[model samples]
Target: MNSVIDLLMNHRSIRKFKPEPLAPEQKKAILGAAQMASTSSNVQAYSIISVTDPLLKKELAEFAGNQAYVEQCGLFLVFCADLSRLRNVTENCGEIFHQNTESFLVASLDAALAAQNAAIAAESLGLGICYIGGIRNVPHKVSEALRLPELVYPVFGMCIGVPDQEPSLRPRLPMQAVVHENAYDTGAVLEGIQEYDETTRRYYRERTGGQTDLSWSRSMADKYRLPVRPHIKPFVESKGFKLD
Candidate 1:
Protein backbone atom coordinates (compact mmCIF):
# COMPACT_ATOMS: atom_id res chain seq x y z
CA MET A 1 0.00 0.00 0.00
CA ASN A 2 1.05 3.60 -0.52
CA SER A 3 2.50 5.30 2.58
CA VAL A 4 -0.35 7.81 2.85
CA ILE A 5 -3.05 5.14 2.53
CA ASP A 6 -1.23 2.90 5.01
CA LEU A 7 -0.97 5.72 7.54
CA LEU A 8 -4.67 6.58 7.23
CA MET A 9 -5.85 2.96 7.46
CA ASN A 10 -3.78 2.39 10.60
CA HIS A 11 -5.40 5.34 12.40
CA ARG A 12 -6.23 5.09 16.08
CA SER A 13 -7.24 7.81 18.52
CA ILE A 14 -4.35 8.53 20.86
CA ARG A 15 -5.34 9.42 24.41
CA LYS A 16 -2.00 9.16 26.23
CA PHE A 17 0.70 11.61 25.12
CA LYS A 18 4.25 12.45 26.13
CA PRO A 19 4.99 15.76 27.89
CA GLU A 20 7.59 17.02 25.39
CA PRO A 21 6.55 20.15 23.51
CA LEU A 22 6.43 20.25 19.72
CA ALA A 23 9.18 22.27 18.00
CA PRO A 24 8.19 25.70 16.63
CA GLU A 25 9.11 24.69 13.09
CA GLN A 26 7.06 21.51 13.35
CA LYS A 27 4.06 23.47 14.63
CA LYS A 28 4.25 25.79 11.64
CA ALA A 29 4.34 22.91 9.18
CA ILE A 30 1.29 21.26 10.76
CA LEU A 31 -0.73 24.48 10.73
CA GLY A 32 0.28 25.14 7.13
CA ALA A 33 -1.01 21.72 6.13
CA ALA A 34 -4.31 22.50 7.87
CA GLN A 35 -4.55 25.81 5.97
CA MET A 36 -4.08 23.87 2.74
CA ALA A 37 -7.34 22.00 3.24
CA SER A 38 -10.19 22.96 0.89
CA THR A 39 -12.51 25.59 2.33
CA SER A 40 -16.10 26.05 1.34
CA SER A 41 -16.33 28.88 -1.22
CA ASN A 42 -12.70 29.51 -0.25
CA VAL A 43 -14.23 31.50 2.61
CA GLN A 44 -12.06 29.61 5.15
CA ALA A 45 -14.65 30.44 7.78
CA TYR A 46 -12.67 28.90 10.62
CA SER A 47 -10.14 29.94 13.23
CA ILE A 48 -7.88 27.86 15.47
CA ILE A 49 -6.59 28.90 18.86
CA SER A 50 -3.30 27.24 19.84
CA VAL A 51 -3.83 27.07 23.58
CA THR A 52 -0.83 26.86 25.92
CA ASP A 53 -2.06 28.52 29.05
CA PRO A 54 -1.97 25.99 31.88
CA LEU A 55 -4.93 27.45 33.78
CA LEU A 56 -7.02 27.76 30.63
CA LYS A 57 -6.16 24.22 29.58
CA LYS A 58 -7.25 22.94 32.97
CA GLU A 59 -10.53 24.79 32.69
CA LEU A 60 -11.02 23.46 29.18
CA ALA A 61 -10.24 19.96 30.36
CA GLU A 62 -12.97 20.26 32.94
CA PHE A 63 -15.42 21.77 30.46
CA ALA A 64 -14.58 19.01 28.03
CA GLY A 65 -15.74 16.20 30.34
CA ASN A 66 -12.54 16.10 32.39
CA GLN A 67 -10.61 14.55 29.53
CA ALA A 68 -7.10 14.66 30.94
CA TYR A 69 -5.48 14.40 27.51
CA VAL A 70 -6.81 17.83 26.64
CA GLU A 71 -4.50 19.35 29.24
CA GLN A 72 -1.76 16.73 29.01
CA CYS A 73 -0.95 17.02 25.33
CA GLY A 74 1.88 19.27 24.13
CA LEU A 75 -0.47 21.27 21.92
CA PHE A 76 -4.15 22.00 22.20
CA LEU A 77 -6.12 23.66 19.42
CA VAL A 78 -9.69 24.76 19.69
CA PHE A 79 -11.07 24.96 16.15
CA CYS A 80 -13.92 27.39 15.86
CA ALA A 81 -16.61 27.85 13.24
CA ASP A 82 -16.21 31.60 12.94
CA LEU A 83 -18.76 33.86 11.29
CA SER A 84 -17.89 36.90 13.37
CA ARG A 85 -15.50 38.25 10.74
CA LEU A 86 -18.17 38.11 8.08
CA ARG A 87 -20.66 39.48 10.57
CA ASN A 88 -18.46 42.54 11.09
CA VAL A 89 -17.93 43.01 7.36
CA THR A 90 -21.68 42.89 6.72
CA GLU A 91 -22.35 45.27 9.60
CA ASN A 92 -19.80 47.72 8.18
CA CYS A 93 -21.81 47.55 4.94
CA GLY A 94 -25.02 48.36 6.90
CA GLU A 95 -26.26 44.76 6.75
CA ILE A 96 -27.39 42.56 9.63
CA PHE A 97 -25.94 39.11 10.31
CA HIS A 98 -28.34 36.36 9.31
CA GLN A 99 -27.64 33.74 11.95
CA ASN A 100 -29.38 30.72 10.47
CA THR A 101 -29.03 26.95 11.01
CA GLU A 102 -27.63 26.44 7.52
CA SER A 103 -24.93 29.05 8.11
CA PHE A 104 -24.03 27.40 11.41
CA LEU A 105 -23.80 23.94 9.78
CA VAL A 106 -21.63 25.30 6.98
CA ALA A 107 -19.19 26.98 9.33
CA SER A 108 -19.08 23.90 11.55
CA LEU A 109 -18.29 21.65 8.58
CA ASP A 110 -15.51 23.99 7.47
CA ALA A 111 -13.94 23.88 10.94
CA ALA A 112 -14.15 20.07 11.10
CA LEU A 113 -12.59 19.50 7.67
CA ALA A 114 -9.74 21.87 8.51
CA ALA A 115 -9.13 20.18 11.84
CA GLN A 116 -9.00 16.72 10.24
CA ASN A 117 -6.31 17.96 7.87
CA ALA A 118 -4.26 19.19 10.83
CA ALA A 119 -4.70 15.86 12.60
CA ILE A 120 -3.39 13.97 9.59
CA ALA A 121 -0.42 16.34 9.35
CA ALA A 122 0.41 15.79 13.00
CA GLU A 123 0.27 12.02 12.58
CA SER A 124 2.58 12.24 9.56
CA LEU A 125 5.16 13.89 11.83
CA GLY A 126 4.89 10.92 14.28
CA LEU A 127 2.82 13.00 16.70
CA GLY A 128 -0.24 11.51 18.34
CA ILE A 129 -3.56 13.40 18.54
CA CYS A 130 -7.11 13.05 19.78
CA TYR A 131 -10.22 15.08 19.04
CA ILE A 132 -12.29 16.12 22.04
CA GLY A 133 -15.93 16.24 20.98
CA GLY A 134 -16.84 16.96 24.59
CA ILE A 135 -16.02 20.56 23.70
CA ARG A 136 -19.67 20.75 22.76
CA ASN A 137 -20.91 19.42 26.10
CA VAL A 138 -20.73 22.83 27.76
CA PRO A 139 -20.79 25.17 24.80
CA HIS A 140 -21.15 28.37 26.82
CA LYS A 141 -18.24 27.44 29.07
CA VAL A 142 -16.13 26.65 26.01
CA SER A 143 -16.99 30.00 24.41
CA GLU A 144 -16.33 31.89 27.62
CA ALA A 145 -13.03 30.10 28.15
CA LEU A 146 -11.91 30.88 24.61
CA ARG A 147 -13.29 34.47 24.78
CA LEU A 148 -15.22 33.80 21.60
CA PRO A 149 -17.57 36.59 20.52
CA GLU A 150 -20.97 36.33 18.90
CA LEU A 151 -21.25 34.56 15.53
CA VAL A 152 -18.26 32.40 16.55
CA TYR A 153 -18.60 28.97 18.14
CA PRO A 154 -16.30 26.22 19.31
CA VAL A 155 -16.90 23.19 17.09
CA PHE A 156 -14.31 20.93 18.69
CA GLY A 157 -10.85 20.69 20.24
CA MET A 158 -7.77 18.64 19.24
CA CYS A 159 -4.73 17.54 21.23
CA ILE A 160 -1.36 16.90 19.62
CA GLY A 161 1.84 15.45 21.06
CA VAL A 162 4.11 12.41 20.97
CA PRO A 163 2.48 9.19 22.08
CA ASP A 164 2.93 7.85 25.60
CA GLN A 165 1.42 4.52 24.60
CA GLU A 166 1.03 2.73 21.28
CA PRO A 167 -2.70 2.17 21.05
CA SER A 168 -4.19 -0.62 18.96
CA LEU A 169 -5.94 0.29 15.74
CA ARG A 170 -9.69 0.26 16.14
CA PRO A 171 -11.76 -1.75 13.70
CA ARG A 172 -13.92 0.06 11.19
CA LEU A 173 -17.15 -0.93 9.49
CA PRO A 174 -16.68 -2.79 6.24
CA MET A 175 -16.50 -0.76 3.02
CA GLN A 176 -19.57 -2.46 1.62
CA ALA A 177 -21.64 -1.07 4.49
CA VAL A 178 -20.61 2.53 4.00
CA VAL A 179 -20.20 2.74 0.20
CA HIS A 180 -23.58 3.35 -1.42
CA GLU A 181 -24.31 3.48 -5.13
CA ASN A 182 -26.36 6.04 -7.09
CA ALA A 183 -29.37 5.40 -4.85
CA TYR A 184 -29.24 4.86 -1.07
CA ASP A 185 -29.83 1.32 0.19
CA THR A 186 -30.98 0.96 3.81
CA GLY A 187 -30.94 -2.86 3.79
CA ALA A 188 -27.27 -3.03 2.85
CA VAL A 189 -26.54 -0.41 5.45
CA LEU A 190 -28.28 -2.35 8.22
CA GLU A 191 -26.58 -5.60 7.27
CA GLY A 192 -23.23 -3.84 7.20
CA ILE A 193 -23.88 -2.41 10.65
CA GLN A 194 -24.72 -5.84 12.02
CA GLU A 195 -21.46 -7.25 10.64
CA TYR A 196 -19.64 -4.28 12.13
CA ASP A 197 -21.00 -5.10 15.59
CA GLU A 198 -19.37 -8.51 15.49
CA THR A 199 -16.10 -6.99 14.30
CA THR A 200 -16.16 -4.40 17.08
CA ARG A 201 -17.08 -6.99 19.69
CA ARG A 202 -14.02 -9.02 18.76
CA TYR A 203 -11.88 -5.89 18.77
CA TYR A 204 -13.02 -4.76 22.20
CA ARG A 205 -12.67 -8.20 23.72
CA GLU A 206 -9.14 -8.68 22.42
CA ARG A 207 -7.91 -5.16 23.18
CA THR A 208 -9.30 -4.89 26.72
CA GLY A 209 -8.61 -8.47 27.80
CA GLY A 210 -12.30 -9.32 27.54
CA GLN A 211 -13.25 -6.64 30.05
CA THR A 212 -15.63 -4.67 27.87
CA ASP A 213 -18.72 -6.46 26.62
CA LEU A 214 -19.56 -3.69 24.19
CA SER A 215 -20.99 -4.29 20.76
CA TRP A 216 -21.68 -1.35 18.51
CA SER A 217 -25.46 -1.41 18.89
CA ARG A 218 -25.46 -1.70 22.68
CA SER A 219 -22.87 1.00 23.16
CA MET A 220 -24.73 3.34 20.83
CA ALA A 221 -28.03 2.63 22.54
CA ASP A 222 -26.48 3.37 25.94
CA LYS A 223 -25.35 6.73 24.64
CA TYR A 224 -28.81 7.65 23.30
CA ARG A 225 -30.52 6.39 26.45
CA LEU A 226 -29.14 9.28 28.39
CA PRO A 227 -31.54 12.22 28.45
CA VAL A 228 -30.36 15.61 29.79
CA ARG A 229 -26.78 14.53 29.34
CA PRO A 230 -25.08 17.88 28.92
CA HIS A 231 -28.18 19.71 27.71
CA ILE A 232 -27.07 21.75 24.66
CA LYS A 233 -30.03 23.47 23.04
CA PRO A 234 -30.07 26.31 25.57
CA PHE A 235 -26.31 26.66 25.27
CA VAL A 236 -26.53 26.92 21.48
CA GLU A 237 -29.23 29.58 21.90
CA SER A 238 -26.91 31.49 24.24
CA LYS A 239 -24.30 31.38 21.50
CA GLY A 240 -26.83 33.32 19.32
CA PHE A 241 -27.52 30.44 16.93
CA LYS A 242 -31.20 29.88 16.30
CA LEU A 243 -31.75 26.19 15.53
CA ASP A 244 -35.46 26.50 14.89
Candidate 2:
Protein backbone atom coordinates (compact mmCIF):
# COMPACT_ATOMS: atom_id res chain seq x y z
CA MET A 1 0.00 0.00 0.00
CA ASN A 2 0.99 3.63 -0.47
CA SER A 3 2.59 5.41 2.49
CA VAL A 4 -0.44 7.60 3.15
CA ILE A 5 -2.84 4.67 3.25
CA ASP A 6 -0.42 2.67 5.40
CA LEU A 7 -0.12 5.56 7.83
CA LEU A 8 -3.91 5.90 8.05
CA MET A 9 -4.37 2.18 8.68
CA ASN A 10 -1.81 2.08 11.50
CA HIS A 11 -3.28 5.03 13.44
CA ARG A 12 -3.50 4.60 17.22
CA SER A 13 -3.93 6.98 20.13
CA ILE A 14 -0.78 7.67 22.11
CA ARG A 15 -1.39 8.52 25.76
CA LYS A 16 2.12 8.57 27.22
CA PHE A 17 4.58 11.19 25.93
CA LYS A 18 8.17 12.18 26.43
CA PRO A 19 8.86 15.43 28.31
CA GLU A 20 10.65 17.21 25.48
CA PRO A 21 8.66 19.87 23.66
CA LEU A 22 8.39 20.07 19.89
CA ALA A 23 10.59 22.60 18.10
CA PRO A 24 9.07 25.91 16.95
CA GLU A 25 9.37 24.97 13.27
CA GLN A 26 7.61 21.66 13.92
CA LYS A 27 4.71 23.43 15.58
CA LYS A 28 4.48 25.88 12.69
CA ALA A 29 4.44 23.09 10.10
CA ILE A 30 1.76 21.15 11.97
CA LEU A 31 -0.47 24.21 12.29
CA GLY A 32 0.05 24.99 8.62
CA ALA A 33 -1.07 21.49 7.76
CA ALA A 34 -4.20 21.98 9.84
CA GLN A 35 -4.98 25.28 8.12
CA MET A 36 -4.81 23.55 4.72
CA ALA A 37 -7.73 21.22 5.49
CA SER A 38 -10.93 21.66 3.49
CA THR A 39 -13.58 23.83 5.06
CA SER A 40 -17.20 24.22 4.12
CA SER A 41 -17.67 27.24 1.82
CA ASN A 42 -14.09 28.30 2.61
CA VAL A 43 -15.33 29.93 5.81
CA GLN A 44 -12.49 28.33 7.77
CA ALA A 45 -14.74 28.46 10.79
CA TYR A 46 -12.30 27.03 13.31
CA SER A 47 -9.65 28.22 15.75
CA ILE A 48 -6.91 26.34 17.57
CA ILE A 49 -5.62 27.35 21.00
CA SER A 50 -2.22 26.06 21.98
CA VAL A 51 -1.89 26.02 25.74
CA THR A 52 1.64 26.44 27.06
CA ASP A 53 1.06 27.69 30.55
CA PRO A 54 1.76 25.08 33.19
CA LEU A 55 -1.01 26.17 35.55
CA LEU A 56 -3.54 26.34 32.73
CA LYS A 57 -2.58 22.92 31.48
CA LYS A 58 -2.94 21.55 34.99
CA GLU A 59 -6.41 23.06 35.27
CA LEU A 60 -7.35 21.75 31.87
CA ALA A 61 -6.15 18.34 32.88
CA GLU A 62 -8.47 18.37 35.84
CA PHE A 63 -11.35 19.69 33.78
CA ALA A 64 -10.84 17.09 31.11
CA GLY A 65 -11.61 14.10 33.33
CA ASN A 66 -8.26 14.11 35.07
CA GLN A 67 -6.37 13.09 31.97
CA ALA A 68 -2.78 13.67 33.08
CA TYR A 69 -1.53 13.48 29.50
CA VAL A 70 -2.99 16.93 28.94
CA GLU A 71 -0.32 18.45 31.18
CA GLN A 72 2.47 16.01 30.31
CA CYS A 73 2.25 16.25 26.53
CA GLY A 74 4.76 18.40 24.68
CA LEU A 75 1.89 20.35 23.12
CA PHE A 76 -1.78 20.70 23.93
CA LEU A 77 -4.15 22.12 21.33
CA VAL A 78 -7.83 22.86 21.76
CA PHE A 79 -9.77 22.93 18.50
CA CYS A 80 -12.71 25.31 18.54
CA ALA A 81 -15.73 25.54 16.31
CA ASP A 82 -15.81 29.27 15.69
CA LEU A 83 -18.45 31.46 14.08
CA SER A 84 -17.53 34.62 15.96
CA ARG A 85 -15.25 35.79 13.19
CA LEU A 86 -18.03 35.49 10.67
CA ARG A 87 -20.35 37.42 12.93
CA ASN A 88 -17.82 40.22 13.25
CA VAL A 89 -17.29 40.31 9.48
CA THR A 90 -21.00 40.56 8.89
CA GLU A 91 -21.36 43.33 11.44
CA ASN A 92 -18.51 45.26 9.86
CA CYS A 93 -20.30 44.90 6.51
CA GLY A 94 -23.50 46.40 8.04
CA GLU A 95 -25.33 43.11 8.03
CA ILE A 96 -26.73 40.93 10.82
CA PHE A 97 -25.51 37.38 11.25
CA HIS A 98 -28.29 34.87 11.81
CA GLN A 99 -26.84 31.53 12.74
CA ASN A 100 -28.82 28.32 12.64
CA THR A 101 -28.12 24.65 13.29
CA GLU A 102 -26.50 24.32 9.89
CA SER A 103 -23.92 26.97 10.78
CA PHE A 104 -23.07 25.10 13.95
CA LEU A 105 -22.72 21.81 12.05
CA VAL A 106 -20.52 23.46 9.43
CA ALA A 107 -18.17 24.94 12.00
CA SER A 108 -17.96 21.66 13.89
CA LEU A 109 -17.18 19.75 10.71
CA ASP A 110 -14.54 22.32 9.82
CA ALA A 111 -12.84 22.00 13.19
CA ALA A 112 -12.88 18.18 13.08
CA LEU A 113 -11.40 18.14 9.57
CA ALA A 114 -8.66 20.57 10.51
CA ALA A 115 -7.76 18.65 13.65
CA GLN A 116 -7.57 15.33 11.79
CA ASN A 117 -5.21 16.90 9.24
CA ALA A 118 -3.01 18.18 12.02
CA ALA A 119 -2.97 14.75 13.69
CA ILE A 120 -2.00 13.05 10.43
CA ALA A 121 0.73 15.58 9.79
CA ALA A 122 2.11 15.13 13.30
CA GLU A 123 2.07 11.34 12.95
CA SER A 124 3.88 11.59 9.60
CA LEU A 125 6.62 13.59 11.35
CA GLY A 126 7.28 10.74 13.84
CA LEU A 127 5.32 12.42 16.63
CA GLY A 128 2.50 10.66 18.48
CA ILE A 129 -0.94 12.18 19.14
CA CYS A 130 -4.15 11.56 21.02
CA TYR A 131 -7.53 13.23 20.60
CA ILE A 132 -9.15 14.16 23.95
CA GLY A 133 -12.91 14.03 23.65
CA GLY A 134 -13.23 14.33 27.42
CA ILE A 135 -12.68 18.05 26.95
CA ARG A 136 -16.39 18.22 26.23
CA ASN A 137 -17.31 16.56 29.52
CA VAL A 138 -17.45 19.97 31.14
CA PRO A 139 -17.74 22.43 28.30
CA HIS A 140 -18.67 25.46 30.38
CA LYS A 141 -15.69 25.12 32.68
CA VAL A 142 -13.39 24.64 29.68
CA SER A 143 -14.76 27.78 28.03
CA GLU A 144 -14.36 29.76 31.21
CA ALA A 145 -10.82 28.53 31.70
CA LEU A 146 -9.88 29.25 28.09
CA ARG A 147 -11.69 32.64 28.06
CA LEU A 148 -13.46 31.75 24.83
CA PRO A 149 -15.69 34.39 23.28
CA GLU A 150 -19.28 33.93 22.16
CA LEU A 151 -19.89 32.04 18.89
CA VAL A 152 -16.80 29.98 19.60
CA TYR A 153 -16.89 26.62 21.40
CA PRO A 154 -14.24 24.03 22.14
CA VAL A 155 -14.90 20.87 20.15
CA PHE A 156 -11.99 18.77 21.44
CA GLY A 157 -8.41 18.87 22.64
CA MET A 158 -5.36 17.07 21.24
CA CYS A 159 -2.13 16.02 22.91
CA ILE A 160 0.98 15.77 20.76
CA GLY A 161 4.53 14.83 21.61
CA VAL A 162 7.28 12.21 21.35
CA PRO A 163 5.92 8.79 22.09
CA ASP A 164 6.73 7.15 25.42
CA GLN A 165 4.65 4.07 24.91
CA GLU A 166 3.57 1.85 22.05
CA PRO A 167 -0.08 0.76 21.76
CA SER A 168 -1.84 -1.70 19.50
CA LEU A 169 -4.28 -0.34 16.98
CA ARG A 170 -7.86 -0.54 18.08
CA PRO A 171 -10.25 -2.64 16.01
CA ARG A 172 -13.03 -0.97 14.06
CA LEU A 173 -16.39 -2.32 12.93
CA PRO A 174 -16.27 -4.55 9.88
CA MET A 175 -16.64 -2.79 6.52
CA GLN A 176 -19.85 -4.67 5.75
CA ALA A 177 -21.34 -3.27 8.95
CA VAL A 178 -20.41 0.27 8.03
CA VAL A 179 -20.26 0.68 4.23
CA HIS A 180 -23.40 0.09 2.18
CA GLU A 181 -24.15 -0.14 -1.53
CA ASN A 182 -27.13 1.57 -3.20
CA ALA A 183 -29.41 0.27 -0.46
CA TYR A 184 -28.51 -0.72 3.11
CA ASP A 185 -28.75 -4.42 3.87
CA THR A 186 -30.02 -4.68 7.44
CA GLY A 187 -29.57 -8.45 7.66
CA ALA A 188 -25.99 -8.29 6.44
CA VAL A 189 -25.27 -5.43 8.85
CA LEU A 190 -26.42 -7.44 11.89
CA GLU A 191 -24.43 -10.50 10.82
CA GLY A 192 -21.34 -8.42 10.25
CA ILE A 193 -21.55 -6.87 13.71
CA GLN A 194 -22.04 -10.24 15.34
CA GLU A 195 -18.93 -11.53 13.59
CA TYR A 196 -16.97 -8.39 14.45
CA ASP A 197 -17.91 -8.59 18.12
CA GLU A 198 -15.94 -11.81 18.40
CA THR A 199 -12.91 -10.06 16.95
CA THR A 200 -13.30 -7.19 19.40
CA ARG A 201 -13.71 -9.58 22.32
CA ARG A 202 -10.49 -11.35 21.44
CA TYR A 203 -8.62 -8.09 21.03
CA TYR A 204 -9.82 -6.76 24.36
CA ARG A 205 -9.02 -9.99 26.16
CA GLU A 206 -5.50 -10.04 24.74
CA ARG A 207 -4.89 -6.35 25.37
CA THR A 208 -6.08 -6.55 28.96
CA GLY A 209 -4.15 -9.72 29.77
CA GLY A 210 -7.28 -11.78 29.92
CA GLN A 211 -8.72 -9.64 32.70
CA THR A 212 -11.53 -8.07 30.68
CA ASP A 213 -14.51 -9.88 29.25
CA LEU A 214 -16.12 -7.34 26.97
CA SER A 215 -17.39 -7.32 23.43
CA TRP A 216 -17.78 -4.28 21.21
CA SER A 217 -21.56 -4.17 21.47
CA ARG A 218 -21.47 -4.80 25.21
CA SER A 219 -19.03 -1.96 25.81
CA MET A 220 -21.03 0.41 23.65
CA ALA A 221 -24.27 -0.59 25.33
CA ASP A 222 -22.78 0.14 28.75
CA LYS A 223 -21.49 3.49 27.57
CA TYR A 224 -24.94 4.63 26.36
CA ARG A 225 -26.90 2.98 29.17
CA LEU A 226 -27.32 6.43 30.65
CA PRO A 227 -27.74 9.82 29.05
CA VAL A 228 -24.45 11.36 27.99
CA ARG A 229 -23.50 15.04 27.99
CA PRO A 230 -27.10 16.16 28.11
CA HIS A 231 -25.92 19.65 28.99
CA ILE A 232 -24.10 20.10 25.67
CA LYS A 233 -27.07 21.50 23.75
CA PRO A 234 -27.76 24.24 26.29
CA PHE A 235 -24.06 24.97 26.64
CA VAL A 236 -23.56 25.35 22.87
CA GLU A 237 -26.66 27.53 22.66
CA SER A 238 -25.26 29.74 25.38
CA LYS A 239 -22.13 30.12 23.28
CA GLY A 240 -24.35 31.80 20.63
CA PHE A 241 -24.56 28.76 18.35
CA LYS A 242 -28.38 29.07 18.63
CA LEU A 243 -28.55 25.70 16.84
CA ASP A 244 -32.17 26.35 15.94
lDDT of each: 0.87, 0.95
Please provide TM-scores, in order, for all candidate models, with all chains considered together: 0.94, 0.98
- On residues 89-160, what C-alpha lDDT tens digit does candidate 1 reach at each position? 878999887877877777888899999999999999999999998988887888987899977888889999
Clashing pairs in 2: none
Clashing pairs in 1: none
Worst 10 residues of 2 by lDDT: 235-244
Per-residue lDDT tens digits for candidate 2, residues 118-230, read: 99999999999999989999999999999999999999999999999999999888899998999999988998999889999999899999998788889889999999999
lDDT of model 2 at position 186: 95
Best by lDDT: 2
State the lDDT at 180 in candidate 2: 94
Model 1 stretches astray by more than 4 angstroms? 227-230
Clash counts per candidate, in order, are 0, 0
